[model samples]
Target chain A: MSLSALVLHKNDNVATAVRPLESGDSIDVEVADCAVKIVLLQSIPFGHKFALQDIGWGERIIKYGETIGQATASIKKGEHVHIHNVEGLRGRGDRP
Target chain B: MNFMGYRRRNGSVGTRNHVLVFPTVICASSVADMISRAVPGTVSVTHPHGCGHLGEEKEHIIKTMVGFCSHPNVAGVLLVGLGCELITPELIAGEIAKTGQRFEILSIQAEGGTNATVEKGKTLAAGLLEEAAAAGREPVDISELIIGTNCGGSDTLSGLTANPAVGVAADILVTEGGTVLLTETPEMIGAEDALGRRAADEGIEKRIREITSATEVLAKRVGVDMRGSEPSPGNIEGGLTTLEEKSLGAVLKGGTSTVRQVVGYAEKPTEKGLIIMDGPAHDAVSNTGMIAAGAQVIVFTTGRGTPLGAPIAPVIKVSSNSGIYRRMKENIDINAGDILEGKDSIKTIGERIFREIIEVASGKATRAEVLGHNEFAIHSLGLSV
Candidate 1:
């Protein structure tokens, strides 16, 4: 059985959970026709994103094959990607 | 294809024939409310502007008010003013007169007080409603339609299903020679390359950049990031992390039509096809700008389910999931969730929404209208002085 998740594009490094996914749940997702199986490292709420591979801090996070934001902290594979761990590079009024 | 609509005297097509009661200032809102309540069938709109505004703010308030007052969807307007406000009913009434539509003005100070003015307004509003009631729908070509596309309470599936579905409908409309307006400048943050590439010309491409980049500048000037706000707390809960991600999904409602024109807030478009109106991402005000810009109907997509309706036009909500669709049945009109459930294709859902638009334009009331969701608001560009 496969957990529900969707990867929008081949270049996207994150997959969004179509349903609530728990830690350790294995979801087989096609990252743009390239099938990859990822084990959840953290519980991902419905509509949330998870890393397909380990993402280094400050590395651009790709979704829809474009930069959505950059990782503020290092993200392990299957770790939840959210506001707490990522910062949008655009429209940043806080940065000098 | 043709749909039944009210053809105005100025050669404009109206999806609904409404007798509108408009307040020029917040102070006159109560008077407008009283007048509409007294006149049963009349619709009323009020805003937080009309007095003490300066420069572009004042002009924007007047233009928005005038746009609504002179909208083709409105059969007639009863403009109520507080007499001392900068945005006088006479100014708005004069603008409407140029459109050759029916309108009447009521000044509280000139009529002696709220009681006397409201009594006069009731008479005027009742007359307009009577005239509107007698007006019947005639066949208007589908090409005359200008649709507004927006998304609120969005989520990850929004991009996957409802937004793209709305986009499909937008594409269908554009193909049929109808006009489509896409706005929410704040949401267009990171999707510039995708949107700008679709521009009809070099000037249009520059405008797409100007509007999106301006949103960031405006936010920085206010000393706050667009993160928490543009994604919104609801958006974050629904899994949208950044303004770019949300915008990438948000813009899908515009479909893939060429960008024919880029308009200022509430300004009517001169070109057909997919046009962009510069405005913020807030749903109510964003909807307001499009309605003022001459969209007769709005196809709004939502994953979290927003119950917003325009005072003058119908808002057709497309839900992203069956769960939220079931919970907000009264607020939502169509279910694009079938695509996500593997029951319906995106193209199928889009055709269904396009069909719904024609039906709604033919005088079928939307859920928002049937449920009395007459939500209205004005965009604020600067601090009120």
Candidate 2:
């Protein structure tokens, strides 16, 4: 059986929580078409995002291979990425 | 894909043939309302804006009045104004003239009094009613349809079901060559990068940033934390924990189409593929902006349910949660509950919505329309008139 979550792109540093995911639970992630195993570091609610890689403080968080926001706090791989850490960066224009 | 629609003199198809009595200033609203009430199939929007404003604010009210009259659904327009107001009836008529639409004006001062203006307006509106009645539905292409999408009373299911379903419908309409507009600037705050990636070109992307930043700076100056103000209490109770999370769901209403153009509040879109309008997140105000942008029809997606509708446009309400569907059956038109229930995919429900749009455009009344829900509001820049 496949995991209920989906990671939209290889370059995306985040994966979408299609289903409620619990901390320490393992799921298969197809990064760049190569299947890799990653365990959740925290409970991720449905429709929320989880980090695909280590996110440094103040670094932009990439999802769908685009910067949706920046990490207000450092996030380790497989941890939930949301308001507890990431915050929207205002004033900076979008990259075309 | 064809529907029978009333064809206007300017070659635009109207799903509804309405004789509208629009007030150019707050001073003439009561008189305008009297005229609308005296006539059937007429609506008068009572707004507090239109006086004591300068520059763009004044211009926005004038343009919005004209756009409402030129809307494809309106067969004829009767403008009511105080002769000395910044937005006079003549100026309103002048803007309407650009659309080649049928319009007439009545000025209270010029008419000698409110009673006189009302008497003249009623007479003029009566004649316009007959002219509107003469126009009948003709075969119209789907591409000619300009649709607006809005989401309100959002919950976690909104992004997961209703919003994404709207996205699907938006994508389908664009593929069919129809125009779709996405608005509510504040709701797009945490998700600008995602929208920029969908822009038609570099310029369109830049425009999105400029408009979004402008809204943020304006909100900051007013001492409101825009992001904190997002995800209303209802939204938080329904499972959304952050503004960014809410925005991710909010942006899904546009589907995955390329952004064709960006417009200011009440500015009509010149390009026809997909556009974003600068609008507030409030239901009535945002709906007004969309209607002013020439949207002949609106698809309002809700997870917690809303009873909002535009006076001139037919608003088709789509409910994301089954509980809301059952509870607010009188207000909702379609149920996107299948996505939440895991019975059907988002694409399937989206196609269902697309079909519903065609049906509504073809003269089938929406639940909101049947309930006679015509709530109108305008976004103000906090300028006390």
The digit string of per-residue lDDT tens for model 1 on B1-385 reads: 8989999989999999989999998889999999998999899976788899889898888888888889999999998888888889898887879889899889888999989999999899988988888888999889999999889887668887898789989999999999999998877877887788889999999999998778877887889556545666667777888777877777888998899999999999999899999998889999999999999999999988989999999999999888899999999999988876657767899999999999999999999999887888889878577
Measured against the true chain A, the candidates' chain A TM-scores are 0.89, 0.85
lDDT of 1 by residue, A1-96 (tens): 333787766788898888899999988887655679999999999889999999999998998677888999999999999988888865332232
Listed in order, each prediction's TM-score against the native is 0.87, 0.83
Residue B224, model 1: lDDT of 58
Model 1 chain B lowest lDDT segment of ten: B224-233
The residue-by-residue lDDT of candidate 2 on B69-132, one tens digit each, is: 7888988899998888877878878877888888888988899997888889989999999888
For residues A16-88, write the lDDT of model 2, one tens digit per residue: 6656888998877666757777799989887677887899999977654556678889999999886677765
**lDDT: which candidate is best?**
1
DockQ score for model 2:
0.13
Model 1, position B233, has a per-residue lDDT of 68
